[model samples]
Target: MASSNMNIPSGYVSSASSPDWLNKGDNAWQMTAATVVALQSVPGLVILYGSIVKKKWAVNSAFMALYAFAAVWLCWVTWAFNMSFGEKLLPFWGKAKPALGQKFLIRQAELPATAHYHKGGSVVETAMSEPFFPMATMVYFQCVFAAITLILLAGSLLGRMNIRAWMLFVPLWLTFSYTVGCFSVWGGGFLFQWGVIDFCGGYVIHLSSGVAGFTAAYWVGPRSSKDRERFPPNNVLMTLTGAGLLWIGWAGFNGGGPYAANVVSSMAVLNTNICAATSLLVWTCLDVIFFKKPSVIGAVQGMITGLVCITPGAGLVQGWASIVMGILSGSIPWYTMMVVHKRSALLQKVDDTLGVIHTHAVAGFLGAALTGLFAEPTLCNLFLPVTNSRGGFYGGVGGYQFVKQIVGALFIIGWNVVATTIICLVIRLFVPLRMPEEELTIGDDAVHGEEAYALWGDGEKYDITKHGWLSDETNHDNNKVPSGVTQMV
Candidate 1:
């Protein structure tokens, strides 16, 4: 963070020391943290999406994520960042403006005005974003979050969504649904003023994605019956590889939340790992006890839920509380996915391909609610300036914060459901949300004119005599093609 090196010319003053506002170490960490988070979306979700679905659906699934990453970045600088962090226009939103001008991008970043917010009648405390970096760094960091939220939602529609619809849906959802949550929780909007805590993005990212994904799934409808019945992963190893990236990459996710290289960032990173590990182990144990065989997929789901669960309180709660959150995140979501989903018509009706509803929605809500119970006053003080904002266990106004958490979630849930529905409906007018029957039956080969895997020898077929799925004549859903040699780069 200090500047003493002799890299400057005799007359030239380097930014390394000229601007007193910049902290070299902090800026470096923030940018690196943002890069790590971006990895979670690109190759992380991309690989996971491709490997977790059946062979035929792999390319489309991965492409959705890859495309979202680029699209969100373009839209982000053009206007979405300002919509998230610019001056407040609506109580729950910021004014839309481009963040692309060099003057704006080069300047130091700042939180929105700290003055009280107002309704038709009164004023309240809005949350603030005071990161110590240039506008370019802040914009890049937030864009990754926006991109990943869309990718997570893609998990729900991987096999059935029309690729064109998905391309459109990404921006629409980011514009309306995603920006709303970002403003509310992190960008100094209504919920922030109301003291609804979301240390990272348990609510803004996970809950919103979960609810929106489920709603979109309902609107787009389920996959073909045969696919719904037997959509086994094409490659569990690759799934694990992606899961590993998501797991380790989260250190950057929460670490960057504090927006500086500090104690809070360290705690957040530690809590993230603790919660995820406990959740993974607890989920594995339940599988062994109940199913008599531990399932890798179930473990990955638990890992994700743990990561989501601790996000709201990552730096706010104690280490022990992270363990408790992980246990509940693992067990409750597990039960919901296993028992209740099978029993509830509503859950059964929506085909959440990866059980995103359980892992994200259920666990995210649980984390937010628990943050109200376990948030330590001292820790709370470090993260935010809210008065009397400790959790219920701390015994003050904290219980009220619990109610606020639920209400805040209700608002987020309500907004995402309605917004996602509207976006899908609008996109439907121009493009069918679901793939046509022929495309659905043929999967990626029909939609993308490509497959996730192909033979080393040939193009049209996989060599019927040796490798499987050799003929174009094979029925995709029924064909038992051997998993192809991965074209991993």
Candidate 2:
């Protein structure tokens, strides 16, 4: 019996299915977390984008997000995954390599660049993050994060970007922009080594997407003048459905950061919900007071901001601090979108369709900054490689930690801006970043040869004459469809 079992790993219980190094619970949880996060991209944001834009542009907007999710997966496994979590290539990047081999997949997951050593006068602290799960689990978990960032960026370019250009943009941006940010922040690049607190992805995913999305919107230009003036949600109820998924699915988004079903994950999940609820309430109150009526769209924005703000410190701060962060998240982003954006010429010039700059960029920066203030020392010890790390609120070396967080956010923002611009410019050399005038005017039907809804005239696409819709030909000589149909479109 002993001779027959010679090849089994040491401490192997009995069956090959149960390896000593593999913690089944942790592996299962990680996979489950990854799936929910993936859902946030596919059906979550996909539904949101599909229903939130002008009806004519629904199919194109959803397709952009769907295409990005699929494209990121392939690129992630082939090379981008390693460039994010493999050996260091530069201070802010990792070496590119394929992560598809079975030998590599079955091995225990370890972020080599995440190893750290600290010497405080007479004491030394050293640690490395080695999750008790196969590398496949880690790869899939990280891939979802990458995919969602690209999909989020699509929000800003929604009604007008060329599908062909966007298809190309996804893989290239994943390669040049997203990988660098992922490597630097979460994959143990310079920011991680410097002890910048990004407990989840305040800087990596939210901030990066917000900045890149805004920048891409600038390069791609605005939507049709008519659409921009009158764009309204095709279905607010469906938008809420997607928003609910995003809110619930975030349990896994932040929870999975620790790579285990442990205390930290539980804490993260709780904090996530607390912050989101607080922010939603605060946002609703503001809308009632300002507009004299609560706006569901505004409430969703608040929920998103709260979620983004808590992500960087979800497991590292107390629940009270989450409420504090939530209050600010609800207010600050609301002000930016409602007041500051209107006053700023630069903000007005960029047609960020979903206001990602306000919801993600501003909120993400606020969260990262707050994390530097509220991150508890004991909690930091549990997850951070840098020992003795604490937020500014805890005193001692906490001040330095806060500064590190801001610096980290700046690096991510600057990198995404430059990389996204370069990517857009490069793609423009081959294909137009914005669709031609006709496509912008016609929306999805012109771009994709399909429409999201066919409610008029024997299931045919919208038509003024065939559908017998009335129009004021004298008032708008060029207008084809009736005013009621225009609203529906």
Candidate 3:
């Protein structure tokens, strides 16, 4: 018989409803945190991408994010989640298996392969991560992280990627590229065992997305030449709204990393905001000095870099270190995006629609290295699996930790470059990597048969004469206009 005690307090309970392994507080916080992180993608990045791009690309840009979110959820539950956090299939890969059974969901959340042994022959064993929550909660939390990474990668290929190719690319890249990075950095692969500190997802999410997005952009080629030169945002205010959601949603993004509503989670939340605020101000100041005025877009870019920069050490570093990270994250990625990108031939040749490479990749790598330098020993003891792990500034074996960070970052970069390229190439064999030239000129209406805004001339759809669907006119949705409505001339 299953026990159904609903009012049980703290301490272990034998009831089926209140399992001994369950911590109600942690479970509640974990679910809440996961919900907010999911919000960062559905409405946060969706609005950001929709408004940041030129008017014509708004629908396509937003849809790419929306579609990826839904697709990743399905793929994650069916196979990708286990391949990321389940039984080890290889040093950097996990076995593919369904994670949808009631038996699997009710078990206590655990990272089976993350247990580490000490180098010395002391017979001491570090325990695996066993968060005091049901496996269902863990699955939900990790699924959001996986979904957001795919959406962030979509930022680079927006404004040009073929919808069909994007549809194909999302699941493929998530399986081949994302799972490997997630496993290696966070799921107890070589990097985790060797003491790489990705406090949240600096390497797995940001760095992998950054590198993969840029690589995919390169293969997909540039947007139409005309739009590239004069791509103005469709709605700056809405973009700011989206940015605000992202900014606040990160409270969960970093806070949930500890898998508990404990001191480490509290510290992580504070550090996340501090770094983001400092970076935003620094970026604005730089824009004023060089461009003669504050740029909203530049400030948003700064905020993103700061968030990425502190992610690798959010819980393991002191607050002061976060400000230092913020200063660098704001300026360095700014310089690369504003100055180096213009000078570098390869960068200019590849039109990364949202500069994801600079914001995510560069900042992620920077955060990883800085974490190697700044991770506090005491704080590390609270969160890290490896005992006595300290940053280089703390002396002892810290320098080796720094080297491990670099090696881990390099592995992610190398793997993404290879995996993303192969995925794009394989996608190309089936369909064009880019939309047709006619569709390119017409934007959303041509590709998705819709427009984001229908403000002109009686609110009718795009002028079919100029941007009609190329496949067949009869299939067009707008053709069946209301009886009394007037069509746009």
Candidate 4:
């Protein structure tokens, strides 16, 4: 029998039938944290993409995000959640099922048998631990992770992608690709059994997104020549605001990975902040030295790389280790994006709109590798029953951990590369990946029927049609041409 008071205080007690304050508090925090993450993908990433893309593609890119946000939720509740976290269907995947029944939602649960088992002495046959929160919370929390993964993939196919093709791709990829990755590592599949240490989503989320995004970009083809020649971010401030949200929202991102508020959560939060800050500082210094001017955009990219690099090790490394990871993440990705990407003909041909390949994929892999180098046995002890061992530098476990990290990362990268390529090729056979040439010419307005900014100052609104600037008769002036029409040269 399970101990009911596993998380509750010993001295004070409440009826099991009645809800406990602590449980309620945990649920609230988890839900809020999940919401914060959801925001990062929706308005946060949506706005960021809108501002970062050339003006013509802003609405289309933002709409892609919005569509994914809504589409994934439906797929998540209906089936994708179970396929990723449900009972194992195979060593590398799980069975797909709907988990939204009222009874299923009401039941309390624990981590599945496939999840990491730390408390028991025998790792080979340890029993699964149960969770305190209702199944509803677990389903919702995992949904956010799934949704964001698809959103991240959107970054690679932006600018010229047809909305219709994306709509089909999101669910198809979620079912075929995303579920396998989630199940293998997180849902107690083969990777978990192999002792792969992904504290959060270094492999499942970032690595998978990065690889899939880069590959999809190749298959989808590049943006128009004109669009690529002068593709400047229309609104840098909006991108900055999204960057701010991403930084703070990571508190939930890494902190909540432990599934409870505890010392590991605290450590994860602190380490995340340290790595991100250090990365930003390092990148800014590099920018000043190279370009003779510090670029805010460069700083934000550094921050993102730092965050991505630290995510896999957030709960497994010490404060000092985090600083090292930050520096490496900042410097390495910077070199890849600036020096290597410019020189590499392969990368130049593949138009990744947000550079997700470098920022998330390369940085995510680097972080995971660093985790092997720096994981503190003490930190692992806090969550799992594994004995604490020093990393390569600490002289305890020389090259074993590093080897394990490489194995895990390669598994993810290779799988995504193969699976994503096949998925895109098949999808492209039926639905075209790129928008029609005429639609591409007019951009977002012709496709999505929307624009990101109106720029009406001080509550002033202008009717473009009423000015006789367009051919619409409803807006034509019956008496004469509108004032500003002839004023223009």
Candidate 5:
């Protein structure tokens, strides 16, 4: 273990202050991971939503994601961060604290009791201790997770959701719902105390987001009739870019969970990529076999499910285990989306815009279960606290870990379903979630006063017509047409 003298001040551990290459390397990687995640939501998913929605609603969908990204950050730094990572608030939450000031940016962090820090070896080790990076790093890292959760939830309410209602919902849900999941599962709540290991955030982020999204969408209603029937992606290239970003961004998504750079982080990054590639390959193969051709879009969805599936065990499982998880995730989610969705009369009533229920919720739950089967003793040992033993199949451990995984999953799903439904109903009492029918038909133009694209004759010409305005060139050119000229007549 790395040495660190604890006699120094509360926030100044020597390992954190040392110039060790490993420490610096890990910090750099963590920052990079954060940046990648940020990109996934910004131009990546933003463009993806813009292109994938009906042309008229492209701007609105993209704006929803963009607004969530910004709004979550504000709430994150102000209070949400403390709620998730702060001292215990309850069995399922933590006390709300502010994350402002220059000290937060430059200081190292102490692992909350909820993080399960325990002393180990001569190093005076705690559960998962490392010299802290600047508080800015912690805040930024956690903020990405928070932001993505909101973006994922937005998927369910797309198309018909009023921009004003959505703008109001992002911070409210993050504070009331997301903080609880993050705190309980990862912030050292009862679940963590009971040894529910979520290496990344399968249950906390993906499953919770998926459930909340579907519920919110149900309350918000569906898109216009024309949109539901003939909505084609405006730009497949943009969608591909977003898919690629999500694929690479997951390295940070899973790897950064360790919160420090180490072999575990490397292992997680490698396993994450392995699972995603395998799942994408499997999905493409199935698509070709069944549809006579592989769809890039379908392959992207497979990749996403694979990533979500490996999130809970990225550092704890082997390469071969990841491949197994990948195959299952790809195939299972495909079946759920195709067969189950078609046959389920209940699901048919609510239009889940992007099928987040299949990709995030189902994949997340499956990954959590697989973690119970595949977590390795070696990785668990490296993670500290020693309390985290290997998975069920590993001789020394029993069914306990699997049971813990199930308990955690159920808790998260239940919390989200109840909290989200309540939040929506309460909000509905004052403000309608869906827009007026006329606004729904007119789309982003009627709502945000914006259009996503103008792909005709250099774009400027179309833009002028759509917004009902003429540029200087148009006015000058028309002036040359002569007063009251009737040339065509």
Candidate 6:
């Protein structure tokens, strides 16, 4: 524990004062974690989405991520946060209320009561998860998780969804879908009471986003035939840049879930990196062996799988266990994407722009189940408030705990499928789910009246006819064409 009297850095901290209930170290770390998590969506996914799509769809792809982040914030504070973590309204949800009111925001952060369970659905006692920080810190931290989940879902629906429908989808899904998972798993609802161990949101965020993204992709329809056949990233370097942010930003993600700057947090940070690095290597090795060449995109996919896989048990598993999860995450998702997806008729029908289903949904489920299998008893005791929670390998109640994880995952999958489908159907009544053919063909230029690139001279839009050296030069060399215009090669 950091001493209360620790020297404060000058000018960096706005005020020297802190309340008795607050630990300056915890509060500082919490706020820092929140900011980095926010980075994963803004510049992180934003850049990745923009650069990975075809040049024409770049702006629209990036805007979807940006819009979801902004819209979630408004919904989060107004009522979504409380619906996720406030007082219980049902076994799987919390009551909705504004989190911005000073009376709620200024108080010490409090977690909902989770009931302990033994084998066969027996409850031990209810435990409250109280953190030493102001309510505002908790709200900010949780909101980022909510925001990123929506942004990730946008990955599948990218390239073709109507923007107006997407704007409406975010708030409704946040309110109806995300909140239910948030409350049920982490907010001390029935799943928590039943001894499910999601150290972070393996099921809540990754699985939910992946499943929902795929569902939305089905309803919104595939990208244009041209795009589906040969869509190459407009900027691989920029995609790498965004992938790097998401990789590093995860330090704050797994570390901050403990809501403390403690031993578990340190272990989580180490395990997260270990799993990601190992998974990346495994994926690269497989690619080299089979394809005779390594792919940067494949490497990024491995990195993501590792991250999502470790999330559920980051603080609840040992270092060695993380490596096991990593190796499997890397291989399993790779096979699914490379082999299973190609062979399956169902998978062929849906055009998931970025393969989010493989990276997020499959890898997420793999991680969740592996967490149940390998969760260290000592570590689980440290991270989970439930007295005897442990993974399957630990024996006795451990096997039962693993089963609980599977059950929890099923609930999440079912809910997201129903919720996402309903949300899409509702939005379609007001607006078309798919963009018009003109907009689909023209991409960013048709939708936003802007293009991502201006390779033409003087920053003008490219015009094959007008800007062609032979076409215009022959006619316009008579002082009609611009002075510097040149012929196409």
TM-score, every prediction? 0.91, 0.93, 0.93, 0.89, 0.87, 0.92
lDDT of each: 0.87, 0.90, 0.91, 0.80, 0.80, 0.88
Candidate 4 C-alpha lDDT tens digits along 1-489: 358768777644656533453376567677877888888887888888888887667888888888998999999899988788888889888887898798887667555646444533355444454556677888888888888888888988888887888988899889888988888777777787666778889999999999999988888888888777767888889989978888888888888787777789899999999999999999899999989999998999999999999999899898999999999988999999989999999999999978999999999999988988888877876764235534565666636767877898999999888988898888889999888887777676568555455433221223455532332222221223345533110
Model 6 reaches what TM-score against the true structure? 0.92
lDDT of 4: 0.80
Deviation in Å, model 2, residue 328 alpha carbon: 0.5
Q: Which candidate is the best by TM-score?
A: 2
Model 5 residue 408 lDDT score:
89
State how far residue 394 of model 5 sits from its true place (Å). Answer: 1.5
Candidate 2 weakest ten by summed lDDT: 470-479
RMSD of each: 4.3, 4.1, 4.5, 5.1, 6.9, 5.1
Tens digit of lDDT per residue, candidate 5, span 113-186? 44453431244233434344666777888899899989988877788987878878898899889999998877
| Candidate closer to the true structure by TM-score (higher is better), 3 or 6 | 3
lDDT of 2 at 192: 77
Stretches > 4 Å off in candidate 1: 1-18, 114-128, 455-457, 462-489
Residue 256 Cα positional deviation in candidate 2, in Å, after optimal superposition: 0.4
Pairs in clash, predicted candidate 5: 89-94, 114-188, 117-127, 118-126, 118-127, 119-125
TM-score of 2: 0.93
Q: What is the per-residue lDDT of model 6 for residues 1-489, given as tens digits with 9 covering 90 to 100? A: 456436756433445246667787899999999999999999999999999998878999999999999999999999998888888899899999899888788788996545444532655554577788889999999999999999999999889999999989999999999999999999878887777888878999999999999999999999989889888898999999999999999999999999999999999999999999989999999999999999999999999999999999999899999999999999999999999999999899998889999999998899999999998888877878677778889898888888899999999999999999999999999999999987887787678866677545443443445654442122112212355664221
**Which candidate achieves the best lDDT against the true structure?**
3
Which lDDT tens digits does candidate 3 get at residues 51-107? 999887899999999999999999999999889999889999989998999999999
Better of 1 and 4 by lDDT: 1
Residue 271 of model 5 has an lDDT of: 99
